[model samples]
Target: MQSIRSLAARRLRSSPSSCFTATPASALGPGSARFPMAIFAAQLRGIKASSKLQQESTADTIEYSKLSDEDLNEGLQRETSESGARKPFNVEYLRESMARRPHRATYDFLSPGHSHLLNIALWDALPLEARAGNIPDSPQSSASEETSISQFFMPSASAPANNSDHELPSGHHLVYFPLQRPISLLEPDGTDPAQSPGVPFVRRMWAGGALDFRRPQNMQLNGARAVCVERLDTPNMVMRGGWGREKIFVDVVRRYGANVADLDPSPSMTAPEKLLALENKVWDDADFEERRTLVFMRAKDDVPEEDAAEAAKKPKAEERIIKSPREPEYSFSFTPTPTLLFQFSALSYNAHAIHLDLNYCRNVEGHRDLLVHGPLTLVLMLSAIRSRNTNSQVSPGRFIRMFEYRNIAPLYANEELRVCVRRNVQGRAGDERSVSEPSARWDVWVENNRGGICARGTAVTHV
Candidate 1:
């Protein structure tokens, strides 16, 4: 099989050089030629992120007085209900099932075996610091001796940062998390670990890292100049042993790409406002909290065909079209013609089947079609808005809060789509210039090739 390194090099060679030609390291990052690469290099220099999962779980249960009664009740009730209704997520059962499943992790453009071979090698090379960033419940390294932390960088997949003597093909940058010490698969609530056991095919490869998006875009976005937009569709073979409670599987494919950020292209954004904007963009590009939370949103059941058809045909008024946002607005569009579907079985690590596999979706999960990954959607929005900036003055540390998003519609394959980002009028109310302006939230709308909106949402950025 052709190696991942060869594949990546081949891809770089095959694509037009003028658009995404590799730049010298000095020209990357924010202030220097090395700005773009440097940004990722900094990420590789892992920051001290608080690792409390940030999602609801038994771990979040604090002693009385601090958390509200409502918050406490929600957690307690949810736990009790889950423990009673379903068996806790079966990592073992999933592993065995995955062994029988067809899909495997894939790097874009590589032949299947070559992609797997290349990714597996990188999985072996992943740095411990990068691995530590993904441990749920704040697991510490054995070297730390206590609840400790270390710094590592999350490398950019765009450029071969490790353009070392040895390289993986497919050019997909990947990170793997191997436990410094064995963590029991047992849930803290005390469930039977033996109930539906499966094999331990990939207990060590739990991790997250950015894929070097290799595409370009030149368009007007939110009154700003646009940079290259990435295209990561057909998340077919990628796999992850999901960490924490929902230790199933995940398919992190991004088909729609983002536009890069430039200096206040939007004449409306002032100098200070633009800099302030960097704070949240950087932080979010760094954090993965919301994605972690949604791991718990799996409501699989067999909705009767009548119900499914009825829901699809429900007489809902057409999504009202709007001219502009009451605040900072963002919009993005993409083609999904080379239609793709990513399948992540319960076995391929910790991901659930909700992400891929149309049959499981139809028969087991009971949906109209396969559901699109939420993280993929969020990444698309961020990439879209980020592409619009020229200054690229982002600082992950300055982030403040999450805006909001209402999943306006469900996205499916085979149709071209557009994603839009815009500011929130309510957030800005009187606080227009407050780095905390109404611009924090992005009103996101996903449109199909035929110009129909499938989903809409709002996202808040702190930077």
Candidate 2:
């Protein structure tokens, strides 16, 4: 095995044609160098470079730190007044502004702290380009319309990004897969197969670092920001992150009901001198970390010590451990179906292809099969509650909080994963004016046939 020093020297000594010196990121235009693809790439490389490989390649970057939710809120309080609405969502702008700082992986000292600031920058910049192309052949078409991106992603050509869209390396990829066939997911219900939702838009880069946002609004929004950064790349690798989920959830609820938006609008201001006030409210809010105890299924050989410890520690979950005589919360455990995964990806407007394309997920995100977003568990629970309780409804507006959910295991395809909730009656019981009182504070958890919890939590009800 070669040492990192030797590897660096070998790569550096290689033909100039083989190795190129990267620019100081600052050299690029505002839009040229956006987002921390470089840092993420660094993380991936650092992980692969390790010997044992016990830790995750990417997740190691978040400390989530010990910051109380209120403390986290305080970090966002308007540091000063008149923080004008000057280019708030441009990834490039955010990058350029942030470049001046030191960089760090975990939040600790952050060698410098500009990584996530530009996270949502591109979402605001990716507008649907008209491109002034030749009129379409179809009679239904007008002068010019958006370029439809069904399954292709054209890489950008901006000043050469670090993570160039090149062919997969020898061992990095499991196999080359064609973008054909639907990825495996739950089977659709013939009875109520509503339109599978989501903007399967690909955020491809152009030759000169340009991108076309010709996708639909719901397909994309001001809340998105992406960058194929080179300055942050290692030798022959790349990394990138999307900024639509948070925006999508917020946008969807606002579309359905603005009242719901008020619950927790992270970055917004009012007409009154409440701009700072509004920011402070979020900055000073509590629950810096919203901890939810979840249950997930694991193979008999795969049950984790963390899960075991939690189970043993709170064996019966008596009234002593935030106890409640909440009904023995039990919910449906549908077998994994293709229809479910597709519906979820659509609802999320994510197009990395990992979620739908099991092959892509295994190839890029480097997961065992398809990985489920922790939030999806919450979604399934919400869906079940809606189906079981005839009158209970989900109101996004005035809906105030979620601290955080730590996923302890993966819910593989085809496996039956349960979602259960047994809430504490005296907790923050919701809807002071609801109809039924079947224990608003319910204890919830989902387990597999092996008796392993797949997802679990306590949720309030709005009758």
lDDT, candidates in the order shown: 0.30, 0.28
Residue 347 alpha-carbon offset, candidate 2, angstroms: 3.0
The candidate that wins on TM-score is 1
Best candidate, lDDT-wise?
Answer: 1
Total clashes for model 1: 93
- For model 1, the superposed segments whose C-alpha errors exceed 4 Å read 1-292, 295-330, 337-351, 392-403, 423-441, 449-463
314-399: candidate 1 lDDT, tens digit per residue: 44323443333343344545443212223211112223344455675567544556555443444444444443332234222122
Runs in model 2 deviating more than 4 A are: 1-327, 363-366, 386-404, 427-439
Which stretch of 10 consecutive residues in model 1 shows the poorest summed lDDT? 172-181
lDDT of 2 by residue, 1-463 (tens): 4432344334323421112122222232222212222222233223243423323422331332343444433432321111122212222212222222211100011110111111111112112120111111212234386533321232222212221112111111001111112334311211100011111211111100111111111111111221111122112122222222111000000000001123232322222222223222322221121111211111222224654465556443111222223444445555655455555444433333444678755654345566454445544444343332333232221121221112334565556666554434644443323334432444555454455654454444433
